[model samples]
Target: MFHTAICDLLGIRYPIIQGAMQDAGGPRLVAAVSEAGGLGVLPTFGGTEAALRADIEKTSKLTRRPFAVNITPIGRAFTESRAAICIEMGVKIVTTGRGDPGLSIVEKMKAAGIVVIPVVPSVAHAIRVEQEGADAIVASGSEAGGHVGRVSTMPLVPQVVDAVKVPVVAAGGIGDGRGFLAALALGACGIQLGTRFIAAQESEASDWVKQRIIAARETDTIVSSLMTGKPVRALSSRILSAYEAERARCSDEQERAAARGRFLSELRDAARDDRTYAAGEISGMIRGIAPVRDLIEAIINDAAALAEKLHALAGRS
Candidate 1:
């Protein structure tokens, strides 16, 4: 009953998309979301073509439901190879970010009958994605977890929806059913969430990371580009503070670039050692980790109740 254009296009029961969180969205998490009727996407930021294929295979073994693979073209020449692997593994959907999904890649994926959705932060980016033949667009706001842009969801979603003809999925600061309903009101066909899924039990994020998110307050998050060249929202920590200090000392572009590279290297090392990283301000809202199925059930039930209240208001009008 919660079906929308996205669900119809992707052959899923719900219109919720698990925003491909780096390192957290592994095979188990992806399959769990897909089995719960939401479209789960495997994050491939730290993986190779072979690793992505293996994750797809494992997800296949866990559930027969439809799912997707997220490809972030960051310092990699594996786009074509990864796209081919998705096609070979019978992946019905592919989500892209970090780089422009070139026309050639879009054509190849469409040729293989894959629904391509690109996440964009602004109306210009959304329009560009539409021109590149993306099947849909996810308008990600600055409030979302991980790497983000300047626009917030409230204004960005409607702007992108009006600019592009394809279905728009709103992402950022959306962790509950109220947010989903609000997105629908804003003309979005579906909603994508990252912070909420980060707290899901099936997520591969370390326990320390989850606890940090759970213990955070709404005011504890900060948006800083000191990690990479792009603005990212994360919980404030000592590591981030050091990166911020280094960034402040750099007055020239060259110095800033070097400092950024050093910070990125540190983050890479931390990830390898299973260290904790944070998400957006929504981290404060995540109190505990639950299984993917239970999370979806709670969201659906809450949405249904809200829908009833809206219907009653319409009757009064």
Candidate 2:
């Protein structure tokens, strides 16, 4: 019941894509998602080429199913280098985020017969990637955990679908079967989930971060650039709030850079037990940790049931 064009496009049993979360995604999580029939993606935002190669090999050994590598274009060299590794390692699918992964990189992947999917924040970005030969697009919104744009998913997905010829996947503000079905209704071929997966038992996120997600509310998250010098949405904490306040008070670039460094340090040390991490608005919906397979199955089963209920309602009208 959950099968769609995305499933065919990505060679998966279900039309679901696990977001390549930098902190929570690893070989274990990626393999588990792929084993459960969704396209699990490994993050390479701040990772090295050696790390990416090892992760691909490890995930391959863990599961025979398909998975992907995400190249967050933090720099031109980083993006191009990671793409080369993916090609060298024979990785079949690649996802890109943060910004354009560059036309040259996308073309290289296509030339190698690897599928390229780019996560975009707007219709304009979606159109550009399509022209650059993207096989699919993930329309992530500001409500997402990591680097995000100003728009939310609801309005962003359909506009991108209308603007681009490629398949569109919806991300941000999604955590369950309800959101899964909603994305399909909004013209998405599938759904990509990040924050929800962070609470998975296979996730690499720390206990503190997982517990924070379980206990969080809708308003508990804030989007700040302190972590990566780019807007990232995460659960708010004393350190994050304090940094935001300091950022407001900084009189010069030097002071702001110092403040940013301090915030990152607190995060690195897990100091004060108050360091926060990326989490989407969906944090409020997560209540506990479960196996990655169980989580993916629940989304598919629940979405199928929900679709039937909606069908019955529609027939009545």
Candidate 3:
């Protein structure tokens, strides 16, 4: 009953897709999400070709459901190898982030009967991907984790939907069924959740990371370039505070350069004590960790109920 274009394309029961998080979306989490009827995307960041291949094989053993492999387009040296492995493994979808997946890469994936979904931050990029033969587009907003854009989900989803012919998936600031209903109302075919899934029991995130996200308030997150080289929304931590202090005190380019180096060094050494937790603004809504199956079922059930309530309201009006 809740089927959408994304569900049909990805072959999932619900339109919820787990966002690919570096070092967290391992085989267990990937398989669990797919098993629970949501699309799971495996992260290939900082992984070798053999490691990625083994992980894919492991996930395949865990669940017969379809899943996707995420490739960051930074290092072209290994991207092709990873793509080749994905094709060989019969992966149905490939999700690219950080940059455009060039025509060559897109053609390679399409020639293998794979769908290409690129994470786009703007309408221009969304249109470009559609023109480049992309099967779908994830319009990630500034409220998302890792890297973020300048727009919010409320506006970005509708704009991208209007600009592109392929299905649009909404990312950022989505936590519950109400958010799901809102995304559908905004013309998104599905919702991509990162922060909520990070707190799931199947997630590979450290216990401390999950605890931090559970304890976080809506205002606890800040979008800053201090975390990675890009603008990301993450929890306020000592690392972020120190970076902001240094950036504030720097008067010239040399001072800024020194501050950047120092901050990055500290970031590298940050352990559980000073580690920054990347999460969406919806962190406040997540109360505890549950298994992927329970989590997805509850979200879909809640969304269904909410949709019925809205329909009743409209009938009375």
Candidate 4:
């Protein structure tokens, strides 16, 4: 009942796309999501090309269903190299995030018959990617984890849908059936989930990070550039809280710079030990780690039931 254009375009039973998570979403998580009939995406950020190939190979071995590779366009060379690898590996669907990957990269993928979907943050970005030959667009809002933009999902999805002829998938702060139906109501053809997937049993995320997500409140996440040099939505930490608090009291530029360096040092130390991980605001809503298949099926089933309730309400009104 929730079937949408993305289902037809991606050859999936459902219109759910697991948002590309770098370290957290490896082959196991990707393949699990695919096997459950949703589009699973492998992330190409913070890993080597060799790792990407191995992940794709392993995912192929795990599931006959289609999956996607997301290339974080950090640079022209990085983008081109990742696209080349995807083409070489015969990946059918490709999702690009972080920044615009340029026309040449999109063309390269399209030439290989790969469906290109760029996660955009605004209407202008949506139109730009559509003009650049993107087959579809994922409108990611600031409420998402990792790198984010200024717009929130509620307004961003519909604007992108109106701005582009291609299908738009709503992302950010979407964790359950209500969010699923809301995305469709906002004119999105599908939904892309990030934080919720971090708690999937197949996720490679550390157990502590998973626990943190389960314990988090919606207000626990703060968008701080300190983590990745870009505004990344992550759970608040004492180091970050110190940085933010220091941001307020430091009168001298030198003091602020010194504090920034200290926070970064602590952040690096924490990250090296797997003590830190990025997660979306929706983490607050997630309660436990379940298999990827169960999570996806539950979301679809709950959405169908919710739609019926809403329809009945409308009839009564």
Q: Which stretches of candidate 2 lie over 4 Å from their true place?
A: 250-255, 265-272
Which scores greater on lDDT, model 1 or model 3?
Answer: 3
Q: After superposition, how far is residue 223 of candidate 3 from its true place, in Å?
A: 2.0
User: What is candidate 2's lDDT per residue for 1-317, written digit by digit as tens?
Assistant: 67788899889998989999987999999999999899999999878888898899999999999999999998888998999999999999999998898888889999999999999999999988999999999999889998899999999999999998888999999988999999999999999999999999999998888998999999999988888888889888887888889899999999999999988887788764677688999999999999988998899889989999999999999
For all candidates in order, the CA lDDT equals 0.85, 0.91, 0.88, 0.90
Local lDDT at 198 for model 3: 94
Q: For model 2, name the residue pairs that clash.
A: none
What lDDT tens digits, residue by residue, belong to model 1 across residues 1-317? 77799888889998999988877889889999999999999988767777887898899999999889998767436777788788888888999976675888889899999999999999999998899899999999988888888889999999999999999999999888888889999999999988888889999988877888888888777777865567778877656777778888889999988987887777767753233364877777889999999988888889889999999999999
For lDDT, the strongest prediction is 2
TM-scores for every candidate against the unseen true structure: 0.93, 0.95, 0.95, 0.94
Clashing pairs in 3: none
Evaluation by TM-score, superior candidate among 1 and 4: 4
Worst 10 residues of 1 by lDDT: 269-278
- Which ten-residue region of model 4 has the weakest summed lDDT? 268-277
lDDT of 1 at 279: 86
